[model samples]
Target: GVPLSTNEDSTRNQNLAALYVLPQTSYPTFYDVRLFIDPGYTEAFHGNVSIRIIPNINIDQITIHAMAMRIDSIRVVSDVNPNEDLFSDFTLATDDTHLLTIRLTRNITALQPHVIHIDYVAQYADDMFGVYVSTYEENGRTVNLVTSQLQPTFARRAFPCYDEPALKAVFRTTIYAPAAYATVRSNTPERRDSLKPNEPGYVKHEFEDTLVMSTYLIAYLVSNFNYI
Candidate 1:
């Protein structure tokens, strides 16, 4: 096995309870995140994340963190050729509960910008952390809401990310849900919302890009629950 760096040794277990700490070899400078909730009570929430990053060193593998998600796809695109995609030539493995190691065909240029895209189905936890379902009584009916609590290391449960408290990045987030469930909130304020024509009964709420912040500080919610 390759020797783990001090950063890795310290962060490998940084999850809410784990003790391994993953090293910081690459940094995501920006992230574009989109989520689609079932509207009804469901644990299967779809997510799409696009991240712009700069690697600290030239390397053939990219290791990040993820947990409790079913990844459908992973791809990389270089800024030099935005039209070209490098999805077919890579292998991704999430062998551990909080580790996702991606092996690429070629070495990524050191300090150069690259974009990573991931499509996945993430679970809504009952644990009340990292994109979970919340329940409450409303108007004489039991209401279920979809929300996110990414504090500490729970961000990986919602989406693939560095999952560290020190790795901060800008985020452009969007949430898709039934129009009837109108309200959505995130770390930042809403930019605009539009009907999802192809997916009837759904509206996509887009939020403005966020100030640089750690993944743990990220929060989002989709609910019909009234605000006091």
Candidate 2:
């Protein structure tokens, strides 16, 4: 049996929450995210997310919320000046804290907008949670569905984000799934694929840019549900 500690040092966190949170240093303004998930093959999901942020102070470290994912590459580019990359290196604090610390070779000045682009592959939620699988009975057969629940602090389980409730921002989201799952849903309606890719056994579901909202407000589902 495991011993339980009654000490305040074991319980008290700096953020006054169960887990640590983003420091709001990089004030995120908008997010452009794309996910490639095959419902038939649900072992893992591949995706990328780019966040436009305005730091209020000059800092070399940019920390964001991330959980249950592996980061492949990261790049920081100035919004006003895109001539060179601003990213130096990155490290993931994958404890219960779920913070990704990005170190920059040079400091990003105050009030300047920069975009952080991250490419990674992430695993599906273990349980009925952030992008997990559920089942439905249809004609004496079980059908698997892929969906998401990004309430409260669960958005970080789906992607790397500033998942705080007060950090509201616009979201431009896109997804890739099998064509069999005709029903795809997001907070906003699906839009036409202006930049459609020629991926095999997959179709694109692009959604209209959502109005300014917190990360937890976003929802996505992919299933061949028999509905209008």
Off by over 4 Å in 1: 1-19, 88-97, 192-199
Top candidate by TM-score: 2
RMSD to the hidden true structure, all candidates = 6.0, 4.3
- TM-score for each candidate, following the candidate numbering: 0.84, 0.89
What local lDDT does model 1 show for residue 194? Answer: 45
Question: Where in model 2 is the C-alpha error above 4 Å?
Answer: 1-19, 193-198
* lDDT value for model 1: 0.79
Question: Candidate 1's residue-wise lDDT over 1-228, tens digit each?
Answer: 997578766665455344345656788999888888854858578888998989899877777888888888888878988776655443334455477777776787889898989999887877877788877887798888888878878999888898888889998888888876777888887885542223556777888889998999888888875671
What does candidate 2's lDDT look like per residue over 80-146, in tens digits? 7887788898888857888889999898899999999999888888776688877788999988788
The alpha-carbon lDDT assigned to residue 157 of candidate 2 equals 77
lDDT winner among the candidates?
Answer: 2
